[model samples]
Target: MSKIDSAERARALDLVPVSRETAERLDVIVALLEKWQRTINLVAPATLPQLWTRHVADSLQLVPLAGQVTRWVDLGSGGGFPGLVVAAALAEIPAADVTLVESDSRKAAFLREAARVAELPVTVVPARIEQVAAQLAPGVEVVSARALAPLSRLIELAHPFLAKGAVGLFLKGQDVDNELTESAKSWRISSRIAPSLTDRSGRILIVTSAVPLAPIKEAAGNAKGSTHD
Candidate 1:
């Protein structure tokens, strides 16, 4: 395989300030991501070159929003965005853990390897989101997803986690208002959208409460229809 430019990757990581240890782990994960992308299509082809800023930084921004809490559940952790990234940060905390749920076997394998390479404390669940939410939700303090599904759908899959008192931190692009509007009609939700540090067009959704106000019958079937993990 051709060599990935470490200098360039480090420059991209400079966008977000991290501890030296976390920086080393992220650097390693970047190289591993580039290596895995060659075979499994871990992330989008267009975004691969900017993984540090576009994915890593964007994912890392969620850590502060969640305070000192640990125990996270990242659904559809395809490329291990905020999930594994957060795990690397929480590795120093004795009680910290991030459970990555990915149904795709190949992606799950990549996630497992990435965590091992970074030595982050992550539990890779090679199963669908619905299968594990029931067993994992109650103890979780945070639940996250990125480009996993639409806003309405995200709320549905995260319900189990939120209902169990976990905070939801989801990375969403510009259409967030529309998604929130659509979601409000079916579910009574308590959420806040914050600016993303990595991208001007992106938003970080912090959801605290969600209750079913009504059922959606159309395309997505009230969020439950689309469970990415």
Candidate 2:
């Protein structure tokens, strides 16, 4: 637990630093992602240079917001973004745990390896968001998602977890205004949008509720990949 400077310490938010011990593990994750992506195409290659900020820092930024979150579920954890970063930072917080859910097998494998090398208490579930109906742990306090879908779809994908009493934290882009407008038509959830630490145009949505569409309508929407994915 080396003492980081004020700014860097602020970044950890009373948690742990992603320093030497953690860096080695994170490096392993990065290396593996870069390697597998050549064939599987996980993350956008052009974004590699900002991986530390766009992905890692973006996820880690949440640590300070919820200073003592013990458990979290990350939906659509493609390429491990905030999910792996959250797990790695939480690895330093006693009793902290995270679950990373990804539909892609290659991404799931990367998440598993990241957890192993980082020695973080994280579970990776390789399944589509809709397939895994919301049985999150009863006491899970936080639920996060990154680059998954529109705000409306995110609320639907998170319906299960939100119903189970988890607060939703989703990373969205500048077009949030348009998405929010469209999402309002189908679901009703109270949310606050905040600026993202990594991307100037990105927004972090903090939500508390999500009303579901009727089963008949939901089923119809699913057929078109519009309800949840």
Candidate that scores best on lDDT = 1
Off by over 4 Å in 2: 1-24, 213-229
Please list the C-alpha lDDT of all candidates, in the order they appear: 0.81, 0.69
Question: What would the TM-scores of all predictions be?
Answer: 0.90, 0.81
Which residues of candidate 1, in runs, are more than 4 Å off? 1-12, 215-229
Q: How many residue pairs clash in each candidate?
A: 0, 0
Residues 88-169, model 1: lDDT tens digits: 8788888888999888888889889999989999999988776678789988999999888888778878888999999999
lDDT of 2 at 34: 61
lDDT of 2 by residue, 1-229 (tens): 2111224323433233555655555666666666666666566666555555556667777766665788988887777777777777677668888988776676687778767876778998887667665565467888888777667767777777888888888878899888878987887777888887767888888888777654414532221111111
